[model samples]
Target: MQKKGHRDSYTTNNQKGTVAITDDTVKLPKIGHIKAKFPAKINGLIKSATVSKDPTGKYFVSLLVETIVEPLPKTHSNIGIDLGLTDFIVLSDGSKVANPKFLSKLQHKLAREQKILAKRRAVAKADQRKLSDSRNYQKQKVKVAKVYEKITNIRKDFLHKLSFNLIKNHDVIAIEDLNVKGMVKNKKLAKAISDSSWSTFTTMLNYKAEWYGKKLIKVDRWYPSSKTCSGCGHLLTKAELPLQVRSWDCPSCQQKHDRDINASINILNEGLKLATIKTVGTTGLA
Candidate 1:
């Protein structure tokens, strides 16, 4: 059960039997022949349909369809990705994708809108009127919701494109299994970490890799990818590689390392080892 005044969406299962779709309309069980815009041609068996109303008062229907996905042509390329707040991702091949920080970019605008919302709410309260009945308050509420919706859509778009390109280009992709939940416990970094949306990116990578017949190897969270020397297999002490240290020299090999790049390389090597083990175990090979 959802909390009162909080439920904004519901789903209908077995939509194949109850729902019908035409080029320009959708027929739900109760709602008959609602005109809808088709973003693309729907060419699959409909399993379920979700109807949702956003805080901004926009209604959307999402159809879950079962369809065969054709895998992309093989690139035979592999890459390791190190996710970070500074750069969204650092590739083992020395490439970096900048963190877009969608929330931070629009934070000031959101705050301005939210300030109006708060004032409107106060006005309603001062007038001894219920918030639900206040027109101005509702309007400002929608404005705040629109800002949040914009941020979410932008972030999802970036993640989808990045994940799709990585899946399309790499035969095997390796990424660290970060302890995001634990990492966010740090109050100072929580907001930035949430804005980074690492979990969403990794989730995208996981599903897309499977859909495209590719491999996604997750290096264990415990692995000290950042502290290990990618070139010489030497591990640095925790004191030697503090959180603020961005670059370092390997003591044993005297090799220089850009922290994120070295971590990505190490993650790739470890992922390859894990893949080899899995392959050997599956094939019963020496």
Candidate 2:
């Protein structure tokens, strides 16, 4: 079977290497004669199959069969993921996925260009700031825009691959639906908040789970997915845990906690209910 592009992957297997062409005559294992429509043709050996759409406005299919499962093995190990400003996701499995510090990394160039833009704006020109209409300002704007875009893309790619890896190795996944929009209201953290892309990471995880036949369990928007203890099931009073305290010891269990790991544990537990109910869990949403 020939491989297809990442965005439009397809594979065909069987002695015929193709299914007979016809409307409402698709071949699948066990259920040999099934139904389909345009762009859905018989391809490859019969197997459990499904078709679906994507956010980008496209259709695709996935087939499960006995031939091969590729290197993507299901490890059945689970991890709780904590969302934060100091870090992106802290896994309950004790693996820390560091937040790339995107804004911090790109801050120098951003500040420089922004300063230039500010200087241009301060000129107070009636015709518009000289810098606003100037060729150099426009050039800087493009440069800055591209940098912003590049950083955003880098974050997205990294998050998607990470989520995919998690789905491949684990039986279940847990995460928080952060109050991102509300948190961004803080003037000081707004830029860093925008760069974090916590929501985007969750989006990738949501769909990847479904595609891979894994579980994406979401705790709740209001639940403190982070401030609870996974080991002792003890919750710190809201004032007990402060933003800067990245590490602590659970009072009840006496287990030392890395903020992310603890949050992850809470998420894992909360996600269990979701794993059992399709209507409850939204671990991954494309």
Candidate 3:
């Protein structure tokens, strides 16, 4: 009751927090002057900073540094990456990122804890009737929390590695702008789509591109990236693309399509066109 009801006390009694600006040492809330992993070296002046705890209970300090990175001579060879269920990511550069389905493998353990948590919830409610101590209930909650934490850590590690590799190697990366909400609504392939981790991949790619002096291109969600024939640039008029159809030849172009690679090429071209427009002082391009 106190934990749930005493919101005011929680904030008021929190330890003092301060952001460490560039060249200025500021004391952290609980931990004092811990050195930053890497000083943000930027072209311009330093700005405000924010520190927060993530859902997995990890504390992170975010430095908002004022900076300008002059883009390198444009590579002119932009590549698009298609996130996948089986292969994880298929890049136009012919690079493949293997899908390590962390959640699927951990489902049994997660389900076990969830089942236990459900049972504990019932017990907690019964105890509420008896006005009993919540020590065991709290323990069960922690067990469930630990499983979630493990899942999050696995995801973070995978994303960081994937993002770093892409940013390091590619000059301009293009991806399909995914409407996760809309994709989730399709119950048929929802699990596979979620497991593909397109949302996470896009988010990581976006931030990493900024940090690594790479350009990110986000094509429209509705754009027929997948259905378009990469070689001939012909649109596919198929009513439905089955999940099982890994490769197909375009009816119009007769070009064989490796589904993911075809999508990646379309994304790449779209990104290249957008970059050209931006360079030519166009704010909006149709």
Candidate 4:
């Protein structure tokens, strides 16, 4: 059971043999063939479908299918990723991906629409009318929802493409086991951190690596990847490596380091050690 005015969608389980999908339409139980546009061809056997409606008044159907996925060709390459706010990701190979900041790009427009919706809600309450019965409020609500949906779709698209590229080109990928939940507790950084969507990006990397038969490793959170110098393995004190310092010189080796790239390299080294241990344990070989 769903709470009143809470759920906007429902799911149908064990829909195998009860549902049929074509290139452009889906046949569901109780509902006949409905015209739908799919992003790509559905190739596998459909097991279940969850039909959902967005606040924008658009209906969507998600099909769970069983299919065989072939692994990508081996590249014999490995890399580490450092996730950040200014840059989306910095790789151990010295390449960096810029943060798209999808939410920030549309913040003003979204704010304007949301303000209008709030005013409409106030008007509806003043008239002693249910929100569902208020046409203006409903319309404005859809507008606000559309803005949010746009941001989500754009962000997901970017993450998927990036994750796919990394999986396809590399045999092993290492990333930090970030405590995003704890990090977001900082009031000043909460909005920026949420907008960065670090968790979503990592989740994409995890599943994509599995699908491509690639290895994804998470370095321990307490490892202090950032405070260590990649070149000479020199560790920095907390006072020496402040948050504002993006680059620094190692005292032990006098090696110049870009903070994110140095951290990524450390993650790569640590991940390789972990991977070797895992392999030896599984194979029972020294």
What would the TM-scores of all predictions be?
0.94, 0.63, 0.74, 0.96
Give per-residue lDDT, candidate 4, residue 220. Answer: 96
User: Which candidate number has the best TM-score?
Assistant: 4
Against the true structure, what is every candidate's RMSD? Answer: 1.9, 12.2, 5.4, 1.6
Worst 10 residues of 1 by lDDT: 1-10
After superposition, candidate 1 runs with Cα above 4 Å error: 1-4, 14-17
Candidate 1 vs. true structure, TM-score: 0.94
Pitting candidate 1 against candidate 4, the one with the higher lDDT is 1
lDDT of 4 by residue, 104-187 (tens): 999999999989999999999999999999999988888998999999999989988999999999999999999999999999
Task: For candidate 4, list the clashing residue pairs, or say none.
Answer: none
* Number of the top-ranking candidate, with lDDT as the measure: 1
Ranking by TM-score: 4, 1, 3, 2
lDDT per residue, candidate 2, 113-211, as tens digits?
A: 778756555554544655546766566556666666667767777887888888888978888777889989999998787788877878888877776
Q: Tens digits of per-residue lDDT for model 1 on 156-263? A: 999999999999999999999999999999999999999999999999999998999999999999999999999999999999999999999999999999999999
Error of 1 at 126 (Å): 1.2
- Report lDDT (CA) for all predictions: 0.92, 0.69, 0.71, 0.91
